[model samples]
Target: MATDKPCKNLHRSPSPAQCMDHYGCIYENNHLITLLVDPENGRIADANRAACEFYGYSLRQFRQLLICDLAADPKSGVQEFVEKALPAGDEQSNRMFIDRHVLASGEPIDVEVHTGMMKMLGKNCVYTVIHDISERVSSEQRLRESEERYRDLVELCPEAILVYSGGIILFVNKQTERMFGNKKQELIGKRIEDFFNEVYFQSAEHNKLKTTGLLKERFRIEQRLIRRHDNRIFDLEISGVPVIYEEDKALQLVIRDITESKRELERAIRLQEHRHAVSFPLDSKAVLEKLYIPARTLSGDFFLFHKINEKQVIGIIGDVTGKGITAALNISALRVMFMDSLLSTQNPVQVLNDLNLKALQYLGEDYIAGCCFLFDFGTGLLKAAGAGINEFLYVPRGRDCERITVKGAPLGMFESSEFEEKSIPFESGDRFCFYSDGMELLFNSDELGRDYGYLIERFAGAALQDDCTWLGLNIQ
Candidate 1:
């Protein structure tokens, strides 16, 4: 609403400024949606031809809406300030105030409201000049929603996802926020290179992973991520994949914490090497040796050794379910438990009972297959027990041989799996061979895949614990 101030030309002289209502278009560039709003509720008192055209309605239709309906802000201060200038003298009302006007169809039009003494049929009437701001508002809303959608999805994804282009992180997810120890908003537009160590930035693997994506098969790599606070260091398994983002090609990185697994692997590697080197050669003509090899860095198959007598030994070859770090840890625990038989009980049944007790204590639900053997030199008595383990061969000197039957289920498979040792007379030139299920079968019958039985045949007679253990005893 445009209001008029008191006539300051008190001398009764016909001043030209007071006689003529001085007004023009609010904005020179815009002509549509021009309307004079009533200051109380921002209703259109009058609308120009351009204002009617811009609103997609006639002047009569434009008069039905209020300014508050179109502008996001319901309490528009621009309207209140314009009404305040009406009581002042004409000198104070000479200036203009910019205001936003709401149209009939819920659209806001910006206006520069000029105030002056207006004589319309000899009565004071407020006439407001409006400028259509639809293009500006629509553009701003589109931009805001676009940015918000991306930002929200990034934070919501469970994966440690990040959107990085060139060097900066355009977006980061909630998991990534936790992993990096920073807020997603704080990381936006920040250089990702700063978070990575110099080695990662310098590595060829990083380049290949980022540039070529999964097809390159170089997605996962260990990297160092330093926390800004307290200088804490954490190991991260970083996987970068290439993506098309915002009309530009970019890289999305998923970082996983691999600190615990990495430490365990380093420990297992050293221990496996030590376990292989521990079996040194002796002067005895009759001795048994076993070896094991896993395709991965760790194997489930391992053996426990004990000196049963001055010239004889007792041992058990074990293969726990699975062949990664989890199985390796369980196998290590089993080895420690197997050696405690001397301190606890020498009975094969008791040894197995104690192992189950320990497995129940530490292990979850993983199972194991094992072959337990005890030898006595004084009586030349060789005792062997099978618990889920099969493919055991006893080759004698005169073409007589024996094979072990699968008797018991895998250890840890049941809470009460037991063992019973079977004795055999050991004459000179008798041999006993022990092995894991790898000797049984693994791959499907495809020419390209590994034939597990064929592999066992090729590696059955290998060295003593150099790689994998396949114990062959030439009993004398």
Candidate 2:
């Protein structure tokens, strides 16, 4: 895209002194830094204003210096440039190379040099154009370092990491070999389907479709796979993110073994079902109406009611910390403690205190939030105490529901925890509702439209979420 021009005409024989003045004007206004150099001795014959500004030298000073003096390694580079530019038959040919040049301030810079032969003052000379490429070189170095860091990070990760392109394995880390029971080389360039059995291939196909549909997005799934070395099937939790590999779309997968967690989940479900099997009497006199629903196979909520004597009945509703098997175990332990405490003492405050003291024996760092109540139909007196049960609804005869707020801490946290017993007068038509905290999840949904009329207005059109348990008793 560039053309060469000689000072005056090539056939003219102007004086060498006038050569600089005439040639200088020709290249002074050129955008590129331009210089005319004697190819035989490497001496600069003339320099344009742009070259003077670029080298931080005046025209008189720059013309005194040799072309080789500008290069970082002057002797070797200048020799090469002179040899390449002075070849006899290549008068119009251009030679290009990259070299380091020293700036006027002694700072070093990278530049691309374009050199071509020219005739000036009836003598052979070379014209050179220099372009600064320091930023470009620096950018390329940074990109190389960034790619190296990425590879190092992926290789050292604890979880199995893999990169796939076009549905084939393109890369795998050291952990992948350990996890899949194969060498890293064995996975490269192989199709992902080659690693799994037919049953697992079906699941992998489905997952592949999901991942492809979510290009440039992130997703996670749990599935079972058979280890190639041992034929052992285990659960794997795979997380994938779309990425660019060599400028093409690819998927990066991180896999973790979750077989133990899956087994624990199954065990928790069975324990939760068995522990919650303690049923309440459905008779009209004891518990009039009841509803219980667990959010998952394992519930962290429970409700229990037992007749203390002919005239009195005791009941408790509790929400335990956490979910799954651990929560179920704690709920079962708390149930036993609650039964023992109430049987020994009818005072609601004393019963709560006893359970709190015994909780440390069976529970770990977990706590129980609950309200306990005892009703005596003979004396028309009802006593209630709570430890961290925030919502308790009391409905008076032919009246709306009201919340009973008991300021107390959760059981099992502190040995010095205390509970205050609240007493209310009970009448024939007065009804009391006892429920676990999770019951609030369904308070606003159509699922509770049958029993809770006041909540129908409060939680209208809301979705059911957490576990729900409710017990209602009407004083006879």
Candidate 3:
């Protein structure tokens, strides 16, 4: 219920108290800056206390000023202010406008103005409510600038990037266009399946990854893609991370071309497998059984055996300090040196001494854990020297296995390194086992029983973290 009561003095502009009695305290006491203006001329008739404080103007000064004078741009602001204040179809309907207003101190501030036509003091007047939005505008501007910077970074990225949702490609970076040999217009709004090979894209593993990616899980997979211009299939490593695009859940995929690298890796694997291949010599009195397992495509472990005579065989089993192609190349160099050393000496200690000198000269900073041994079947004796790999298992027929350790420093470690040689006389039905340090994962103690075959089976099934090598000799 409202009452429109005429004030005592209606001829002059109303004071704050008089305006409050006419329009209620809401217009004068409201925190938001409120103003009353003549709709026809955009002349400010009255203003609240908040408006006076916000604009640095007293109520008397505000009454003398025009509403257009408060706008940053006064020329067009005059027409704009008057046009909003004038009554249209619905006079009570509020119209909102965002504009810049100048304060008394000459500082421009962004403001949201809500204007409506209303009857005040028996005349059609405009009621204006102003809300300062400078902070919100500043934040929005910073957000836009940040988005522009992120878009620039994405465009300059080296790897192909794509944003996809529901199997359809929503966005593609410049690198993606160059990699797929397609233009921006050609790739956008296309299905991701269209660019990928049909057989691989539809695979169960690939579908599983797609499902996982949609669930916001990060995933990586190797896929084959068909080039649109050439129709040539190429390998691609696609790493996907969940992202939001246009307010919808999507996936961003980083794709790398790995065709050349994959081919080079395959060639290296074949070469390493050939380098590790061993051919045993034919001997009736001695039986040699070995197991070699690599943790990767290339192994650090290497073994070489040369027959000195029908009665004697000399061998060396070594593990380099590192793995991969470098270790494989070191193993090849050591193999050639081992063969040359056999020509000079048949003694285990002298062979290691010669190899150590060569390793110091050629192997650079790398060290080797090695065990060299000479077995004589006719004399029934085994002589072995160790460098880093010091333990050996000796199992005699119908007796418990004995642990034999030959102490020596690792090769290429010191110039004055001394090696100890252990000579054990063997009888008929005795077994000697020599292994690299990786074999310690199976048996930590010195007592490793007679069954070498069972240990090999267990090693085959066990999860191995390093390269392992085992060589066994049986005297029959």
| Candidate of highest lDDT | 3
Query: What is candidate 2's lDDT per residue for 21-44, written digit by digit as tens?
Result: 775666777879888888777888
lDDT of 1 at 455: 47
Stretch of 10 with least lDDT, candidate 1: 442-451
Q: What is the C-alpha RMSD of each candidate to the true structure, in Å?
A: 14.1, 7.3, 6.6
Model 2 ranges off by over 4 Å: 1-26, 29-31, 35-75, 82-97, 114-126, 201-213, 281-299, 302-315, 323-368, 375-388, 392-435, 438-442, 449-476
What is the lDDT ranking, best to worst?
Answer: 3, 2, 1
- Taking all chains together, each candidate's TM-score versus the true structure is 0.51, 0.71, 0.72
Kindly list the per-residue Cα lDDT of model 1 for residues 1-476, writing each as its tens digit. 99988778665765565444333343223564445556545565666777666656775676776644445457755455555435443423645655565555676566555644444445454554545455776788898998799778767776688877766687677897777677878889886555545454667765553342333232567776666555667777778777767777677788778777778766776776676555513227365454456443455767767775576677778777654567667777787778875577765556776776766666768776787777666777777777777446766677655665536666766776666667778778776677666554432222112223554666555433222445566666
What is the TM-score of candidate 1?
Answer: 0.51
Candidate 3 error regions (>4 Å)? 1-24, 52-61, 73-75, 82-90, 208-213, 280-476
Candidates 2 and 3 compared: the better one by lDDT is 3
lDDT of each: 0.62, 0.75, 0.80
